[model samples]
Target: MNDSLPGYAERLDALHQALAADFRAIIARLPWREHESILDPGCGDGFFTGLLAERLPRGVAVGLDTSTAFLEAAEARLAEQIEAGRVRLVEGNVDRLPFDDATIDGVFSAHSMQSYPDLPHALREFRRVLRAGSTLAILETDNVHSIMLSWPPDLELAVRQAEHREIGDEDSYIGTYFPRFAPRLLAEAGFTDLQREYIFIERQPPVGEALERYVELYLKYLAEQTSGRLDAAATARLAEIGDPRSKRFLPRQANFFFGSLQTLITARA
Candidate 1:
């Protein structure tokens, strides 16, 4: 009964691989304990859950996701780790975690809140299960809110026009204001003592020569994905934004990405 996209598990694994370094930095900061239980709601494919197991030698990590496809992927990937009593998988939704109130010692979720039907309700559920004085950690990309593309004067409007993304929608509130908005939500749900950190990957030419190539191809990619969104003038503008051959293109000193930002927020429960 898993309703996940056909290749979601595979795609998720690939993404985790690409994000391995950032993931390690985020996981390394957890105040691990020998006898603690951690809940990872919406854990996809167990790549991170296995990393958690490696970090928390004596602790138990439980991962929950609605997709049986993902659970199976986790099981297959973490077979030895799961057998050693380090990790467990459950099939459920974060909106209604399958656990008693105030039972979980810690909770961590990533890239999952944006899809929740009722975000505040889900936050309440997260707080309900978390033990008082424990930790709640979230890692997400704040592209919708904070990260602006260096090319466009109005990146938000451009995205809206191109992809039909709505203003003040999930893409607006969580995507834009996220971890920035998280502290307030956590406070309302009775959490305090907040900490926010970010791992940024600048998509600049000097970061690598491939970035120049990436930038150059971006215009064509954009045009393919969204045909009429860019007119002739916009095409010329995009070339200036992305084409390394253009005189107006960015020099090596500018450390900027096209339109992406990744962030991690940790707070007390």
Candidate 2:
């Protein structure tokens, strides 16, 4: 197992549990074919892959991920589907797919494109493997679009700016450029009929435990990432609010609210 697999899976599971309804709704919105094969590249743990398989009762969901550990976890999660022959998890890289050209009927990727070693090369590979007129759907979000807590807007803005200044070009922050570049990149890669949608999820006080836990983890991540980038007072404030045991924990505040926006872009090959 990868050294970070436990933490990575926990964070993904918490987020999935918290926003499960929205995630299902988004996947349900896609146009599915009952007898066509769909490729889910970068399908870690098969969370979204299982949903894709559910939509295609008679079709197959081919999940391709680079990590053997992640594929093992995905296999365990989708054991029933795998036995039914509706889902298949493979160890492979997105940019250099193992399949022949133009063999896939459709492709669905989520929150993983930003991590591709080469964005342009991966986009071409997606186009190459997809049949003519097949759809490619990608769901991604920027740090600015992905989070909104009930804290002060000024502090949030400061943290956002700090993140951009520090690691904006890193894979973790690369999603920030997707909204602006995805269309052109897809077009350049020989895809057509591009479209985009913004999905919003929000919750108020009395939110679920999953959401609360996700928020706590996200806060801690933000605090860790911007530890020395922000001013001393701002850094201290983030630490206090991020700590669940602290009196200033924001999740415990009255009228606490949480919201996020994810961008979904679909293109035809």
Which is the leading candidate under lDDT?
Answer: 2
**Mind giving the per-residue lDDT tens digits that candidate 2 earns over 1-269?**
44236555777788988888788899888876877899999998899999899889999999998888788889999999999999998889976898999999999989886677688789999999999889999988865667888987788888888877855354544445577688778999999999999888898878878887888888888888887889998988888887789887887888688888888899999
TM-score, candidate number 1: 0.74
Off by over 4 Å in 1: 2-12, 145-165, 169-172, 202-228, 231-260
| Model 1: per-residue Cα lDDT over 1-269, one tens digit each | 43554533443454456446667777887885757888888887887787787777888889898878778878998898789898989989867789999999888887777767677778889889998888888887764443344554664366437744334655446534566677777788777888887767544444455444444454445545555665667556655665566765643436554434667778887
lDDT of each: 0.69, 0.85
In TM-score terms, candidate 2 sits at: 0.92
Query: What are the root-mean-square deviations of the candidates from the true structure over C-alphas?
Result: 5.0, 2.2
For model 1, where is the 10-residue window of minimal lDDT?
A: 5-14
Give candidate 2's whole-model lDDT. 0.85
